[model samples]
Target: MGDNNSAQYVGIDEVPSPRAVGINKVSLLPLVFLIFYEVSGGPFGVEDSVKAAGPLLALLGFLVFPFIWSVPEALITAEMGTMFPENGGYVVWVSSALGPYWGFQQGWMKWLSGVIDNALYPVLFLDYLKSGIPDLADGFPRIAAVLVLTAVLTYMNYRGMTIVGWVAVLLGVFSILPFVVMGLVSIPKLEPSRWMVVDLHDVDWNLYLNTLFWNLNYWDSISTLAGEVHNPKKTLPKALLYALIMVVLGYFLPLLAGTGAVPLQRDLWSDGYFSDIAKILGGVWLRWWVQAAAAMSNMGMFVAEMSSDSFQLLGMAERGMLPEFFAKRSRYGTPLVGILFSASGVLLLSWMSFQEIVAAENFLYCFGMILEFIAFIQLRMKHPAASRPYKIPLGTAGSILMCIPPTALICVVLALSSFKVFVVSMIAVIIGLVLQPCLKHIEKKRYMKFSTSSDLPDIDHITNEGTLLG
Candidate 1:
């Protein structure tokens, strides 16, 4: 791990040009909120669990799990972000606590998730774009969408954060506003009793768990970048809270309203009846417009991931974890090389249908979440003295208490979900584990020597001994 105690110096002689080399306050919360809100959990068939698992499973997820996993996850990230606020969010924290091996595990998963997920976005975008038509997400069209998203977002990231930030603002707004309108209109139509249904009782236990995995994972991407934010101690916490709030308003509401309006889950995928919630309540003619809007929402989300993942991969490289090539950058300080590598993965997966992408990710997300929660827990114990301006107030007991509900729920979900996807995720993680030794060996070659001193050698001592420059 890079030194967190590294001096924060700036001046003509002390530093180079005083340009912004990192994140800024361009309303990161809105974009961050959109990351959690607009995409993953909603259109990804979460409501199906409610419908399939009966009212019981849906309630556990939408209501109970949010209270458990979502809130605490956000809060912990808030405190961590404000305290460290460096570059590669949880990867930085874990590296500080455990070591580079574990840190790279998280970072590699994060980057790989983005890369793998890139394929899903354009296909979703195409599906939304052709909502009025049929089979647009098939074959060449899906491939084209993948290329376009990869090309455009990669270029924007290659350019600079200023460009990406503005893009985020636009995409966040464009994505959420229409969805909000649709959801709000559909709200009054919901039956309050529908929230209480317990559909999973007689169903297969494993099936129910697999179903729940669809919703229980993926809170790490933004949180991991906690260190990169301005005033992360304050900003990240607020961002997490705001994201949860907005997710309900912009994303979940649509699902609620759409479900209420249509009263079916399996059918929602075919009709995309959620996008039509606005037309059902407020405007009939808005159907096509909303379809266009949903496509934009998916596109915006894709761009956000592309920009963030590029930075994440770049940060990992700078620490000697990844190859030096990933450290290569454009004049704009973007990691074009890493972005290209990531985009290649995206392109390869784009050929698969959206349903397949969602299925595989469903399982991978569960595994990732387990690690993320572990990262948070480890940091508190290991980095006890680290400044955490915005921390979860629960302390050790609270962290432990908060841990139970989410952990129990995840265990339940895993025990219940599709065996195939679960097995696939296990295999992927096993692949990673098998590769760790090689990565460590490569890392050793880069640094060459292990620590020999009781204390970390001072920068001057290192300079005298022909080590790193200050």
Candidate 2:
């Protein structure tokens, strides 16, 4: 932390208010779709979705998950958030009810999951770029594109959130277009008979696990950014619901609508091609729109990823889990050190193990879901009377029931991720475990032995007046 003891609180006349500083509604809503839809799209989405079951079975799973799983889980999130509105979204809230160990675990998983999963964005982007420009499919150009995109995003986020939100909103708009074209044009082209004649080899249990785990992953990210939101409780819950509906449409409709437009074979072969369905309907000119959409979709993810990264860094630093330097924030409130750490990792990851990195994203995703399940159960039971604008109707039993499908789904995915990715994930977790104890020991030593010098400059003093102000 900062030298708070050396610098008096300028606003000690006013205590920190939990209400206004909570989360703004505007940022929260769009973010929900941004995080969710990315996981549910493209060749990847289709692969996970159709591998074990086909469109018919995929649809069945989606239908079963929402009422049976999503609704109750969302409700649990609503209650936990409202009860601990003062905490900086999930990290603080989870920390409060479950203790710092679990809290650190949540934050760690969220950060790593985000950084690891983001490896796919550039790879997928390269795939989309190459799909159109066939020669660029393999060499330096492909690697260059990944480096450029990631660097620029890291820069954009380093500048701060205004840029992040602008990018997110535009991305949200851009990302949806291809899906729109794909669904609107594609749906009409489907023949019901095709559904019956579907091929069976797509049924890979591992692929389905990877696919669906991502389909519904990390939506709680918006809640984490709630500290920046305007009307968090009201805006958060409503925005979350809106994001869900929009995401479901953004994802499901494309597949549904595309059934009519592209041949099943064509759809299966392309990377992130719901936008391509528009070209099928509107002609070659639609490619521009789809490309624009792909760029925008990636932008949405970059914003959330960057935001989550900085926050995780700051939170860890503030709690003394990380070095003080990593927590340092720039004038724009960007976590300069933390942001660099993430960006560097992104840069390094772009070069090494990009393929395994892509698959491993699902592994980190599973770990997050498990934590959310734990948080959901614990917070609901601990803070029974907590004022919540929304509540999952199912008391403890119902919430537990809702958690099961997702929990089981995630567990299976953890196993299903390639032996390489699964092993890497285990290694990463073990590294974290090793560091956890060292961090605790270090913090304990500091708490017992370290102290700042008394000669530090004070921040509360008036500049021209040369007087300390209350």
Listing every candidate in turn, what is its Cα RMSD in Å to the true structure after a full C-alpha superposition?
A: 6.4, 8.7
Tens digits of per-residue lDDT, candidate 2, 50-73, equal 535666656555656565445544
On residues 1-470, what C-alpha lDDT tens digit does candidate 1 reach at each position? 01123232111111221223553443555546434632352443344454456544544456555676766666655665554454466666566656777777777666666666666667666766565666564667655656776687667666765565566666666655666666666666777665544544444444344444444445556754443355544555666666676554443455555555544444343424545555667775566667666666666666666766776776666555666677566766666777677777877777776445666665565555667677778766654444445556567767877877877776765565566766766777777776667766865776532222122112223233332222
Candidate 1 stretches greater than 4 Å from native: 1-47, 54-60, 183-198, 201-217, 224-228, 263-271, 276-284, 443-470
Best by TM-score: 2
Error at 109, model 1, angstroms = 2.6
Worst lDDT run of 10 residues, candidate 1, spans: 8-17
lDDT per model vs. reference: 0.57, 0.59
Q: What local lDDT score does residue 259 receive in model 1, on the 0 to 100 scale?
A: 53
* Cα lDDT over the full model 1: 0.57
- Given candidate 2, what's the lDDT at residue 193? 56
